[model samples]
Target chain A: MKKYTYTEKKDTRSGFGAGLHEAGKKNENVVALCADLVGSLKMEAFIKDFPERFTQVGIAEANMIGIAAGMTIGGKIPYTGTFANFSTGRVYDQIRQSVAYSNKNVKICASHAGLTLGEDGATHQILEDIGLMKMLPGMVVINPCDYNQTKAATIAIADYEGPVYLRFGRPTVPVFTDPDQKFEIGKAWMVNEGKDVTIIATGHLVWEAIEAGEQLAEMGIDAEIINIHTIKPLDEEAILKSVQKTGCVVTAEEHNKYGGLGESVARLLATTQPTPQEFVAVNDSFGESGTPNQLMEKYGLTDKDIVKAVQRVLERK
Target chain B: MKHTTEELEEIASQIRRDIVRMVHGCQSGHPGGSLGCADFFTALYFEVMHHSTDFTMDGKGEDLFFLSNGHISPVWYSTLARAGYFEASELATFRKLDSRLQGHPTTHEHLPGVRIASGSLGQGMSVAIGAALAKKLNNDKAIVFSLHGDGELQEGQNWEAAMFAPFNKVDNLICTVDFNGQQIDGPTEKVLSLDNLQAKFEAFGWHVIVSNGNSMEEIVKTLQYAVSLTGKGKPILNLMSTQMGYGVDFMMGSHKWHGVAPNDEQLKLALDQLKETLGDY
Candidate 1:
């Protein structure tokens, strides 16, 4: 296993804010809209710098989506910021008709996704956003791992034409990836390569997978870890190649087991190569109010959970 | 480019003919709203708006129009064809397989005049306001116009957009509500009463204008006045009143024809009522 460590920790939303400001500077047409969570979404810098291009939609997520879709008509790349719950489930029809069905160039940037949203509980923590977003035609579903990847994704989606749902989290996590890495829309990042077992993860679970990989290495089990950021356009080639080499897989994500990265990987394997797989995610159950770490542990989405899933899958293999 | 009231009315008659013919050909469509808004569509496209026949998605230098009440697409398709956005012969393919003229307005098929897909109600106002904001950003003097059904305001998103435009000072948008008082189920009052619409809009900080939508002269005058009201620091809303079926005697003022196609005899009667001044497609 490759030794991975981060001396600093940062929330992914701040990265989104930094990336938005950078994207705005690079392209004059990039505009940001927020639904009354400017500070929570870490969009104050972009708003302060480009006051004229920013719109404060005042808690109206549906209107924000419609406005973003409309902004795309005149060549403006609008990024709408809100909680993951409000961004998808609350405004699915608006996104479907105005953005996806129309094929508009709008980036729906959602923060505070999944159990990581913490004390806000199930209402704010959206475990099914991945499924809601991926089901829409022409929608690119992206869940970046950490601060650096989130920033890169925020900037990268500005240039990609069409509708994109960029999902990130609120909790501060390890900043392990390269600060200057180029974010690809549909490409998977190979975190660590080993032939014994494959561990696929996304969003906050990527860091956990890395931790689990280190633990697995100490137990004399070589594991191949793959970071799948883009879930909709799943990097089938990368996944198939890694799974074929390992013959077993463990999928981890801070989402429901039914509709997150785990299901996507399982479906891919079942169709292409049929590999033994274990999911380290919340079962089909809503989360309760607790600290991020506590909720993650209680819901079976931690490094230990990934290690256990990997061990279980290895037994199956 | 200025058309006389008589000429606009003649063109509207032709549009009404096209609407009924297109609906009858498809055997499935909403003709009541289409027939009701024919004159308004004719007046706006032919006389009031400063637009180009060659359509582009980024309508930067030209006035943009979005049909929020997309169930009435037949009127818009005819208006677009008559305004030379596309060939008039394409109207025959309305609602047919692989045709750009979908059941509702959509940009999915690369339709020349459509910039956004809209069949879901209460979404057009936000889109119009956003487009108007974009015009302000680009420093374009062009205005954005949108039309909505009266019953469509039942969706909560409309109020969200309605509250947004005024507070944000989106002054370059001119939205009109087809105040026909009729919907698919029944009259709007029975379905859901939009109590005191003028007061509602006025309270929302919009310059409200009321006009008879079926009359070409009134629609033209109202639109011109609405255009003059732009850039004055308020979004304008026009409540244009029209009968559900304006021309055909049997269907006039009734909601039964809202989404029903006319049969052979009914089509002949509708054609007899509407004069084909510019000739049928």
Candidate 2:
């Protein structure tokens, strides 16, 4: 397994904020709208830097989405910020009709995704956002792993035309990825190369996959880890090549196992190459009030969960 | 181009005829609101807005209009065609299979003069506010206009948008609500009462005006009066009163004709009432 190290731990939301601040300076057309969660979404820096370009939409997610879609008409690229639940499920019809179906160039930047939202509980923690967003036609769904990658993806999505959903978490995790990495939308990053088992992970689970690879290596088992960030328009070829070499794959994410990255992988494999796969995700259940680490451990979203999934998939193969 | 009320009235009568014909052609669509808003759509397209015949999604140099109550698409489609955005003959293809004229207005069909897709109600106001904000950003002096149904106001998003526009000083938009007391279910009053709508808008910090929507002269005057109130630190609202299915003798003063297409006998009677002043496509 490849060695990975980081000196700092930061929330992916902060990376999004940093990237948004940079994108504001980079492009004149980039504008932002936040629905009463500017501080929570870490949009303070961007709001401070470009006051004229930001709109504080006072707790109306649907209205924020509609306004963002409309701003695209006169050539303004609008990014709406809110919690994952409010951003996706609450204003789905608005995003669908105005942004996705209308093909508006709007960026829906969501923070506090998955169980990582912690103590606020199930209402705030949204696990079905990836499925909700990816189902929309012509929508680009991205869930970057670390702080640096989240920031890079935030900056990159600005140049991309059409609707995009950028999901990030509130928990401060490992900042392992390069700070200067340029984000590629649909390309998967191969974290470590191995021959025995393949591990594909997204969002915060990506770090766990890397840790799992190291653990599996200690156990005399070689594991190949791939970070599949962009869930929709998934990097199928990268996954297939890695799985073809390893002969089996394990998919992990901080989402519902039924309709998330695992389901996508399962469909692709079923159609092209039916291979044995194990899923490490929340199995159709809601999260409760707990610390981010506690919730992750209880819900089977940690490094050990990924390691077990890899072991199981290898056995199946 | 400034058109006289007499000329606008002539066009409105033709547009009403077109609305009936288009709905009749598809045998499915919302016609009640369309018939009532014919005069307002005609006046806005021909007399009020500074628009281009060559339609662009980013209407930079011209006034932009959004049909928030998009069920009333027939009036908008006919108005756009008459204003030279497309051929009047294409209006016949409304709500047909593979036609640009959807049941509700949509930009998906690449329909000229449409910026956003809306059959779902209460979204247009926010969209209009965004465009108006963009115009301010670009330093373009052109205003934005949007039409809504009074029934659509029951949606909470409109209130959210209502609060946003005034707070942000979105003064470049003039929104009109077709206060035709009818919807899909029944009379709007019985379905859900929007009591003292003028007072509601006033409380929302909007400059409110009232006029008869079916009257060409009043629609022209009220729209001009509403425009005059713009750029003074508040968005303007016009409470346009009209009876659903106004032009048709049998369908007027009721909600039964809201979505149902007219039968052969009813179509003939409706056609007789609305004269073919402009040549029918």
Candidate 3:
């Protein structure tokens, strides 16, 4: 197993904020809209630097989507930020007709996604966002692993035209990826290599997979780690290559197992190679008012869970 | 500026003829609301709105319009074709395969004169408010226009947008409600009473205006007056009163025709009452 040294820890939302400011400097047509979550989504930097370009849309998420879509009509690229819950489920129709079907070049930046949005409970923690977003046609879905990668993905999506859903988390996690690494939309990153098992993960679970890889090394179980940042356009080549070597898979994510990263990988493997797989994900249930760490443990989404899943998949193989 | 009653009536008849022909050729579309809003649609496209035939989605430096009640696409398609946004013959391909004219107004088809998709009511107002704010940001002295149905107000998102527009100083938007008092279910009053609509908009800090939507002269004057009230501190809301099924005697005063297409005999009767000013599709 390979070891990565990290000196800093940061939330992915801050990366989005940094990317948004960089986009503002790069393009004058880039505008932002926040639905009363400026401080929560870490969009204050963009607001402070480009107050004229940032719009405060109050608590109206539907109106924010429409406004973002409308802003694109005048050759402006509008990025809307809010909680993942309010961003997708609350305003699916607004995004469907106004942004998706209308072909508006709007970037929907969603923060505090999945069970990682702790303490706010089930109402705020949205585990079904990936399902809702992926079902929409012409929508690009990107979920970055760490702070540096999230910021890079945000800046990258701004330059890429069309509608995109950039999802990030609120908890501070290990920032292991190089700061200068170029973020690609559909390409996956290979963190480590081994020949026993392949561990594919996304979002906050990337770090967990790395930790699981370390534990597996101690038990003589050499696990390969793959970071699947883009959920929609799964890195099929990377996944299939790793599976060809390992012959088994373990998928992890801080989302529901029913319609999340795990299901996507399972579906791909079933069709392409038919490999045995285990999932480290939340069961079919909503979250509770606990801390993010506690929820991760309770919902079987911790490092130990990934390690166990890797072991279980090896047994199946 | 005042419009003569004879001239206003002539435009109404021509618009009605277009509506009947467009809906009949499509064979599947909502004709009742199109006939109901014929007079108002004619007034805006022909007499009131200062838009050019060379259309673009980014409606900069000109008044913009969005159709919230996009189910009544027959009227909008006919009006857009007659106003020279597209070829008048395109109305024949409405709701058919490969036609730019979708069952609902969509920008995906690259339809001219449509800035956004709108079949899912209650979304156009928010889009209009956004465009209005963009106009203010660009320092362009142009008003944003939107038309929504009375029943579409039931979508809670409309109230969210209704509360947001005035609070955010989106005053360049002029929104008109087709208070035709009907939806697909039944009478709006019996289905869901939208009483005190004027008071509702007024309470939201809007400059509320009322007019008879069926009268082309009233619609033209009222829309002009509404446009004159732009760039103020508050958004403008017009509760234009109209009959659900107007122009056609059998379809009049009913909600049954809200989404139903007119029969061949009914189409003939409607065309007979409305003389064709421009060539029919």
Candidate 4:
């Protein structure tokens, strides 16, 4: 496996804030609405830089979504900020009818997604947002791996011209990807080149996949790592090409084992290639109040879990 | 088009006729609220709004209107067609598969004059506020208008939007609640009480106006007054009262006709009562 290192750790939400600030600078039409989570969502920079272009929606997520959708009527690109739970579950009908169905250019930026939301437990840690957003037609679902990619995604979706769900985490993780990396929607990044096993991961699990690749290398096993950032318009070509080369695959994500990136990959493989696959995901269960690291380990979503999944898929192969 | 009250009333009768015919043709739809809202729709489309006949999704340089009570799509479809957004003949295709005029209003079909999908009640208020905010941001000077059913206010989201608009000083929005006192289940008072609605809106810091929705002249006057109240650092609300099924005697004063299309005999009675001054589909 190729050696990877990072000098610092950063929360992905700050990346979103930085990206939003950059987007606002580049385009005056980039407007933002937040349901009173300015600090939590790391949107202070954007709000401070562009106060007139930002709105404090006072904890009304549904209203924020509708307002964003309506703002698109006059060529304004609106981005809504809220927790993953409130962003997707609390206002799903509004997002569906106002944003997705209307084909409005609205970016739904969700912070503190998945189990990494920690201490807040199941109510706040939304494991089903990926499913909810991906099922909607014309919605582009993105779950960036790190701070750099999350910021890039936040900036990229502004120019995409449709509804997009950008999911990020609260925990500060290693900033592995390049600072100036160009983020492309629906495109997978090949993190490492190998031929024995293909490990496809998204969000925080991408880092775990890298660790798993390094571990498998110690056992003289070569692992191919691919980071899938965009979940909706899944990078099927990249997945199929990598899976065909490896002849087996392990899919990982910080989401429910059902209706997530794993299922999306399984669907692609089942129909097109019928490759052996194993999922490194949380079994159908709610998360509990624990520290982020403890929860990731307790829920079996670590590098060891990915390594095990890769081994299991190899057995099936 | 600054039409006279008589000319607008003439158009209202035609719109009502179209409402009944559009519902009857499909043998399904809401006719009561559409009939009740006919005069107001006619007044807004023909006289009150500074909109365009040529259709575009971005109503940037012109006033925009949204239908929160989207089940009354017949009235809007007729108004949009008669106002030259599309052919009046297209009204016949209402509720048909692949038709732009869905059972409720939608922008999915790329329907002109509709910027958002409504029918899931209590959503349009916020959408209208957002559009109004957009107009203010663009410095377009054009206002955003929206209509809602009184019963629709029972939806909690409308209250959220109601609070948001005035708090944010979304002054370029004019939202009117059809105070018809009816929903699909029964009279709104029985279904769910909206006690002292005027006081509720006033408490939200909106400039409230009351109008007779059935009267073309009253609708025109009240809507004009509502427009004059804009840009005053507050959103305006018009609580316009109208009888359900206003023109047809049998359907009037009952919630049964709220979503029911007229049977043949009832359709005949309704057509006789509403004289079609403009050609029908």
True contacts kept of each: 0.81, 0.68, 0.69, 0.80
Q: Write the per-residue lDDT of candidate 4 for residues A134-157, one digit (tens) a residue.
A: 999999999999999999999999
Predicted candidate 1 versus true structure: per-residue lDDT over B91-207, tens digit per residue: 999999999999999999988999999998889989998898898999999999999999999989999999999888899999999999998889989989998999999999888
Write down the C-alpha DockQ for each prediction.
Answer: 0.87, 0.82, 0.71, 0.87
Deviating ranges (above 4 Å) for candidate 4: none
Report how far residue A310 has shifted in candidate 1, in Å: 1.0
**Highest lDDT against the true fold, candidate:** 1
Estimate, for each residue in A1-317, the C-alpha lDDT of model 3 and write its tens digit: 88887998999999998989888888878889999999988887888888988899888899899989877766788999999999999999999999988888999999999887899899999999998888889988899999999989988888888999999999999999989989999999998999999999999999999998999999999999999999988889999999999999999988888888889898899998999999888888899989989999999999999988887888999
The parts of candidate 1 lying over 4 Å away from their true place are none
Which structure among the candidates has the greatest DockQ?
1
lDDT values of the candidates? Answer: 0.93, 0.92, 0.88, 0.92
Candidate 1, RMSD to the unseen true structure: 0.9
lDDT of 3 at A167: 95
Fnat value of model 2: 0.68
Q: Write the per-residue lDDT of candidate 1 for residues A131-217, one digit (tens) a residue.
A: 998989999999999999999999999889999999999999999999999999999999999999999999999999999999999
**Between candidates 1 and 3, which one is better according to lDDT?**
1
With a 3 Å backbone cut-off (N, CA, C), the pairs that clash in candidate 3 are: none
Q: Assign candidate 1 its CAPRI class.
A: high
What are the iRMS values of all candidates? 0.6, 0.7, 1.1, 0.6
lDDT of 2 by residue, B40-60 (tens): 899898998889988888989
Mind giving the per-residue lDDT tens digits that candidate 2 earns over A1-317? 99999998999999999999999999999999999998988889888889999998898998999899889989999999999999999999999888898999999999999999999999999999999999999999999999999999999999999999999999999999999998999999999999998899999999999889889999999999999999988999999999889999999999998889999999999999999999999999999899999999999999999988888888889
TM-score of each: 0.99, 0.99, 0.96, 0.99
